[model samples]
Target: MMQRNVGVVFGGVSPEHEVSIISALQAAAALDRARYRPVPIYIAKDGVWYTGDDRLLDPAAYRDLDRIRREATPVMLDPRSYRTLELVAAGGRRFARPARWSVDVLLLGLHGGPGENGGLQGLCEAFNVPYTGSGILGSALGMDKVLSKMLCRDQQIPIVDFVAFRESDWGYHEEAWLDRCEQELGYPVVVKPARLGSSIGISRAADRAALDAAIEEALRYDEKVVVERAVTALREINCSVLGDVHEAIPSVLEEPVRSAGQELLSFREKYLRGGGADGGKHARRPAKQPAGAEGMASLDRVIPAPLPPEKTAEIQALGVRIFQLFECSGVARIDFLMDGTTGQVYFNEINTIPGSFSFYLWEPTGVSFTDLTHRLIDLALKQHHDKNGRVRTYDVNLLSERSLQGLKGAKQRAG
Candidate 1:
């Protein structure tokens, strides 16, 4: 009914920082101005948070970080107030106090690092702010590849055989770790950082040499690494689930198109290429559009993935299960690795805050980007209300004068 200000928080000190920017800007562009006013809350790579005018909505304007910082107003979240962001003083305000702004809800567009890995979500909780997407536990669990697989395994959800190890486990014992991998999971393994997405630190290892190299690369991004037996004749199918654990729905399936000889979808293939052309009307682009302007929307993929009706339903059901399992709110894209040779599907990983919010997949389902954004904001507000409705504090004061006198008497008796 009434207009609400939604703070679209994005950008972070992460390998996927640029991708986050693209996703956030797309979401800001799609917000229904009639129902919600989109506020830009940008977290720079340096970890400083900023807020600014319409310049924040221009994707091209992000090429120069220094210019953005110069023009943007740096701000910090004040947990003392409900959803208040206080401006940090830069120039002499002389006698004037710093300004503050409030948002009805926070639309999280962050991808990796603290932004999506529970840190920002926790900050929102501390600020008592309503935010979209997963909560602290859900975000933490979804970001962790090892934990996601373990939970899936415990639940009997099919997952590829994986050997998870921390950097400490391989310290000066590379031979032992190599032997373990060679014995348990043989060659042609996929190595990935345990907590990162956008395929930033992922590689396919064919031999011991490549495996070693892959592990080292993965360690650069995260202390933990996951080496899984590569699915033969792999077909990556993704399904996006929207809403919360209580009531959620799955969108149409998507099979991301990979390039020939590309063992895994590199960051380039995922974002750099022009994919909007194949994405239907909302994803269609101009002939002279900039490279990678579409973000994940630009990645070439088949929507409603030419799967049999049964298979489509199976994947969608699985997607919903995984979404509820992770206690995820808002929209998340659950990826499944299907063995083309056997048609066996294995739960791969979950994107808690998927790029472009997987709008392409939902578009065919009759959910426009604007409508999707609206749903997410509404969900955020409802969740906040539900969370705060419960009793959080006690009326009794433990440190009252009577209680203090009793403590003093106990001390005297002990003496």
Candidate 2:
């Protein structure tokens, strides 16, 4: 069997930059060596692109990204090809020239910013290269908390009631906006940067003072901010959906618990909890992961979520419906907020390019990490083929059919 070159695109100018690196590295390491060869594509925080040997896939190597860029070959993806990504790089003063890499498909490991918010996906679409995860529409929609909530509500998908505002709104109508949030959502609302993930700019506000500060803090990260009524008895459940809109299945659910007084899952609790995080205090880890292996799985979580069989099945089915609704391909993790007291579930958000591709969730369902990566590539290829099968351009020569003199005369007459 021929091995396909899979370009694993990771890292971006987002708060979740490190998370992207971890997710991409984990996926690259787990890719099926027999079927696919992983090509590490790193997008620096400053938007520079680089491609190199396996060292780029190491989490430790990224500590000094400036040094890594100096050592790695600067490259760019060719936009004129389909199912064939040409990584073009010219010989420079210091490093030796390297051969161009022909990629069969792209495995996107981007978590936030343009990479996960449809910017990179649009580039792939324009280049006609097969790429994993949600397409432009889904990525853009999923990234916008305000828009996603509206769309889900339109589709009859249950979502928490919330309010959204832009930075400029607070500039003049600060008191008015605050009043609306306090009146509609009441006290104890969750404030978040509209288009960010990984709980980077998220805070729970219990009163007017906290709400004011939380909104201001969230605005620091994004122009738009959303405030949702916080679930008092919140049980955060996340389910991973694989495949595309046509045929996708859900993995077993996982519940992530927040530490006492944490209010919500802060960025600290999510990534900085254990195993080499800032102070080596990472979140709740359910299993002993191998050294250097990291991602969403490293965080504390309860697999299968301790939910009843019927409730688990219901959440899984809902995940599938969401995948199809968003026309998502590849794999995505749909997060839910379940009210422990009422037994009601509400759609919280969608991670189009979930950390580690949410492979850990699938492993319990008999799908290994290698198997999950392989399926994503297959789905990407299929989606690309289907897109190309449709009619794209017209072959008519209008200029040849109409004389310049006749066209001028027609235009003058119409005017």
Model 1 lDDT per residue over 17-57, tens place: 88898888888888888988778888989998888766677
Give all TM-scores, in the order shown.
0.92, 0.93
Q: Highest lDDT: give the candidate number.
A: 1
Q: What CA RMSD would candidate 1 show?
A: 3.5
> What value does the lDDT take at residue 334 in candidate 2?
96
Clashing pairs in 1: 275-298
Off by over 4 Å in 2: 92-97, 275-290, 401-415
Candidate 1, which segments miss by more than 4 Å at Cα? 83-98, 275-292, 403-415
Candidate 2 structure quality by residue, lDDT tens digits, 313-390: 989998999888888888899999999999999999999999778887998899988788888888888889999999
lDDT of each: 0.85, 0.84
